[model samples]
Target: MNTFRQHSKTRSRAVLVAGGAGFLGSTLCERLIADGERVICLDNMQTGTTGNLAALAREPRFSLVEQDVCDPVPRSLEVDAVFNLACAASPPRYQADPVHTMMTCVMGTHHLLDHCAAHGARFVQASTSEVYGDPREHPQREDYWGHVNPIGPRACYDEGKRAAETLCFDYRRGKGGGGAVDVRVARIFNTYGPRMRPDDGRIVSNLICQALADQPLTIYGTGEQTRSFCYVDDMIEGLVRLMRVDPAPDGPVNLGNPGEFTILELAEMVLDLVETTSRVAHEPLPTDDPQRRRPDVSRAETHLGWRPTTPLSAGLPPTIDWFAGLVQHRRADRRAPVAEASALHGVA
Candidate 1:
């Protein structure tokens, strides 16, 4: 059975990180392990690559599961805590396989909740700010009912996650076999980081990739659409704090940086960081994209004593460096010859 040391060796005990090979998941896994916890990473590899878990593989206490969360977890292992981050957060990736995306949230959530029930673990749901849809109010709080269009293309992820949150609460209120079954719901906002996919259409990645490649950064709709960015490290810190909250705050906290910036302003920041001559171009925004999305993190501050600490000016350097490294790796790979590489195997 999974357990924690009473005297404290590292900072955490055993942690189950679902979708641990994706950008956010992998980062969470790394943090958990660094704090002296054994980590079990569950992922299907639909969007996550092995590269995300490579660095963690050498850690004796860390392991990755190549299975989808929709399937039942094996009976042998016990987890002290479960972090359900299996759903896709980016618009393009989730909308690409809408049905599977929904399944991952609905069915995947069921599987994780069941595991939590069996193992007597703390369950943390990686909920999204998208739950608010196009916010009807500024600085969306956890109490806001949201204005999501259930029939829009974006509905698959937005509504699916909303429903998943409901299921979590349902099980918690039912007083199921899961001991305590305390749920930690984090409504995360725009978080950018090192391992993010270069082509996810997320403004940070898009701007960095375009700037590094000296290509024009495409701005969807008016560049005036606003978003608040919390760097990945800050986000992970908030999540961890929420997980370990004493008296176990039955939380649905907004874990995000409240600092707001426009798409165009973010692009300019990227341009300045990468020192690129890349120009900005306007493109039609996809369906149901939120024009203004920022989190109201007062509850997090008042309850969890957590708020983002990383400034965008400071955060962009490392992110730009990461993408720059990836671009260089790709360019070098392309020049190496066809026999040595195959697109089916994926680029670095």
Candidate 2:
């Protein structure tokens, strides 16, 4: 446990964000720190990057712990709350190592639940809309059991999250052999914003990166598959509200914007935002890809009083700018080595 040396006085709260160096986790860490909470960011750095935490480099209230959540947490560490955002969320990344992804969702969640049970800390499980796999429900509500194929290529992530949700409720029901743990589960939908990795195979990042790089925006399948998008800031607010809401909700609450759009609509929007010669290209849809996904966030609104405020029109601009900056930086970095080699060869 790294101590906050500068703040001699104890802070109001200490929150541990597992997978905190990742896209959403890093943003949550920044928000918590800005809200005057001491944050212990635990991550294995598998899909996460250290550059995401650069903003907090000099902040004493923030500490980064490089470790896998599947392992037992240190007994000495104490926190008021724990946000389990540990597993790889993207399909390409999670499917790359299916077994590890499953273990991270199951064992990693078990470890965190145990820690929270012992410490009497509130726990927030960042379950996903994927749990509602290829959902038959028009607008997926918390009660939907999901239409997941247990043995499909994407089953690793879909089933893993479902298992994690089971663990959370089990702990909450005191079935894990101890007092009931305070637990909240948020079924997050498609969220996008800054800090998203260009290589992440999500639609938002994919189209944005391709447009920035002058490559064709690949649309999977017929491009009519619909999905709801929530801004990262809005998602963070929902999570915070879920954590602090009185009397934790009995079941998972959907946290996302209900405004839905097709993949073609998103690609068109991205192309319009970015100044590039990129055109739309069709491709084979991956296995178990959901045709339509729109969260019914009535549960979130009723319980947490949270509803997404940012529209896609408002959100995509900043997201494009962030990806554009990253694309530029990467291009510059790649050229630097070549330039150095050319200089060494005296090839002006």
Q: Which portions of model 1 miss their true places by more than 4 Å?
A: 1-12, 175-180, 331-348
> What lDDT does each candidate get?
0.81, 0.87
TM-score of 1: 0.90
Global lDDT for candidate 1? 0.81
Model 2 ranges off by over 4 Å: 1-10, 331-348
Q: Write the per-residue lDDT of candidate 2 for residues 37-143, one digit (tens) a residue.
A: 88888889887776777777657787777789889988677877899999899989999999999999999999999988877788999999999899888888889
Q: RMSD of model 1, in Å?
A: 4.7
TM-scores for all predictions? 0.90, 0.92
Please report the candidate that would top lDDT against the real structure: 2
Clashing pairs in 1: none
Instruction: Please give the clash total of every predicted structure, in order.
Output: 0, 0
Clashes of 2: 0
lDDT string, candidate 1, 158-202, tens digits: 999998898888777755455546677889899998888887778
